[model samples]
Target chain A: MIEPGSFRDPTSRVFYDAGRVFRGLSHEAAEVDAEVRSSGLMNDLVSRGLFVDNWIVNDVTPPSGVSSVSVIESERVPLVTYPAEWPFSILKDAALATLDANLISLERGFILKDASAFNAVLRGVTPVIIDVTSIERFGERGIWTAYGQFCDHFLAPLMLEAYAGIPIHRTLRSRTDGFPIGDLGRLLRGRSGFRKGVLSHVRIRNFFENRAAGMETSERRDVGKATLARPAIVASIQKMRGLVGSLESCAPSTWADYESALPYEESSIDEKDRFVSEAAVKAGAKGLAVDVGANVGRFTGILAEHFDLVVGMDNDPGAADGLYDTVRRSDFTNVTPLVVDMTNPTEAFGWRGKERAALSDRLHPDFATWLAVVHHLCLGIGIPLDEVVEQIFDFCGESVVEFVAADDPMAQRISATRSTDLAPYGVEEFEEYVARRGVVLNKKPVSDTRTLYHLKGR
Target chain B: MTDPLFAYIDPGAGATLAQLALAGTAGLAAIGKLRMNKIKNRLTGKVSVDSESEPDVPSDESAATE
Candidate 1:
């Protein structure tokens, strides 16, 4: 079946057949592919681990109506995440990687036709460009055509995060095409409007965009003739890289230091780790394992040892960013960190809400660790214990859930902020919900107020 | 097979035109900076080769057309 998201580009179409991913290129796209391959650029990108590994497959039959076809098979990304689900640092890194890829392509007499953030997928902490067909020969149009897209898809959102303290991940959820330049321009119209990149990248670009929009087709074509020298184009891209590199997320740090300030005793932390590890091993952790509420990835590190692939998810941008930094620094090749709130996860969106699959549909982990997360969903978010249990079972077959009693310091701290009484939140209520939805294989008391349960979905 | 261009996403005409203008400005600024550095080196009695003075290599403009 043709990949729903791969229909926009007519020259190439991505399809899956019998668990294998394939890209069927038209005769025209094949010629471009041959040129790029012959130029040795593809091998260079693949060797550097910057591009997805794909090889020509001659055995696969082409789809009907095409005169001829060149089929390429690709290594599928374990989990496909959109830019909206990434933390600030992850998105920043992806933007830099895209620019680097484009710069490298320019050196090889080619350029990326589109600068869409969707073209890149995070494998572990590294972002790899998956849209091989986006590369094409650098045409005589001496200006980079995808400049507007880069500004829209990367620069605008990043600037908002850096300047206005707005989290791009949340903003990007609805604006898949990246933030509109005009809207960004108006939003940053105060002091931030005069910030370094804001004036040129957002305001000036938006002005030109509006002007071009109002022009006649003939007038616009005349303006399109405006060109620059190759060196100048390269310099502009380099300047963009410098500007993007300088941006730092100004979003207030939350849960970034959660591990440092544990509400429970230090021994309890180690005890919880042991319990989670034992549960994972008992469940035969070989497939994907997710560390939900993985603030700074204390338990994600443990799951990484047993599972083939581990995903560390946290709603806090700072926590997810911290996890990404730790994973990259430690060179953990199997863990993918995501910024996701369990209570309000990413929903299905895009063309007919079918182009991009929702988070729950994509993640079917063999094992999951919901350490210190249930109380936040139930007491903090006011979600019922049964509903939280059902959501957990929906994502994984088996999980290690940590139950924090309402009297616990952290739970009290969460409940104190709410006007609603959470006095009924106790061990009995949790176990009843678990019994209704699944079976608890084992239980261990990590602390006076916290207990770990190894649960299997019915 | 005949169509050489497959630019599916519309590269905004205004943005493209603005990029050309911006690149030109950036190029001029770089040249100015290079000239100032060259002058500074001369005053400081540091002999340095001015690579910017070299002739430009001809580019392959005919390689591909949109």
Candidate 2:
């Protein structure tokens, strides 16, 4: 069964059961029902290849007391994917889909009552509008009726990623409803500088946003009954999309600085890849595989050899994007990349309640890998080795994790910070901590310092 | 190959759009009625999705287990 996403707008969210999809629209949105029908928008869109997202008057009635106002129903989608799992191009398409949906709604004599990235979802690689009932009539609209919302969701995140090379939306884990304009403005402050469009859309606008911090929740503010005079609204969204397309990361990273600092010899890197791949095939894992600290998914590709699907999780935005690009370009549909610090994994989507959803609440992988990642977690991130063991056991049944002994070049470099506390961290301590939780059967020394533990649950 | 388009793009929106247009026009027929009590009509029949009424929603315990 498909679970409902956190799309809790006042309007109805579509639900699909068995084989049919349904949306539940209330009287508020149904006010323009007649006008919408007369405008032939539904018909026009149907003819122009719009999906049958919302159903017409169907067999299932809107519960007993929904008579005074109409509660129209619509079709539901099969599955819902969160924005965090989406690739760069997928987000771009969602942005375009939202703008397109808004334009289409105007042509049919209706205006989008609300706009949020959550309103769109990915079907295959395309973004589709999930809530058709969100459209409502409010008389003639202005040139940019949806300008503010577009700014909040699509435009803001896209601009930040393009110009600053930072996936700003990842910050949503802290502040929901996309990024708060205030925080985004603050994040932009320390940034080096910006291009022209960034100046108009974010930098300058932020000065004005700072003027009114807690005046009112942006969602609840009264936008008035101004309709987006169809053309104006469509033109507005289109212009925003065009504006988005114009922004681009100027060039790749300065390869000289990072690339030249080659810590590992080519043979050593190859040996690590071969070691992870060999262990996974030996383990006979068949379902999902997860790679912790999957920088650019190098080991994810290796571990992927033993599973149907692989998830490469990393905290760095650049790492996730790089991994996603590699997977996409290679047509490796089996791999899914996400931005998540192992120390601060997504506890939950926070839909029903803010319970700490065990990491497996979303994915249940059979096997896992931790190649060259343990050092970052133990020494760099400061998560206790014991808790790290528990988190790993929570997600995988059997796994191969490489422990970068404190003396390993990487670990030593990570802990080079004089302030770090690595007194309680060591391969012996990790082995003992994980052994109490699971069977640490073998400790095969991969090198003079690091050791690979073959772990299995009780 | 993954579709170059975003995954959420619906294949059946055309049919739904047609039905919405038809229903929209039907509702417009009562525009005069809508105006006289539009405010009241708009707020009417809002389904307050209270926890008790949300039967399909699963509890945390239920979600964790199979």
Clashing residue pairs for model 1 = none
Q: For each candidate, what's the DockQ? A: 0.16, 0.02
Give per-residue CA lDDT, model 1, range A1-458, as digits (tens). Answer: 77888877888888878878888898888998998899999888888888999889998865563324789888888888889888888889989988888888888778887899999888867889899878887743355768999998999899998988888877798556899888888788678888888877876677667655544343344444445566677788999999999999888878999888888788888888899889989999798999999999989999999998899999988888889989989958898888887777888888888888888888889999999999988888898877787787888889999999888999889889796654357799889878887999999998889999999989
Candidate 1 residue lDDT tens string, B1-65: 11236667676666865575477675334324333333233323443443224212222122113
Best by lDDT: 1
Candidate 2 per-residue lDDT, tens place, A9-50, comes to 434444445555555555544555556666776655445433
Error of 2 at A165 (Å): 6.1
Model 1 CA lDDT for position A421: 58
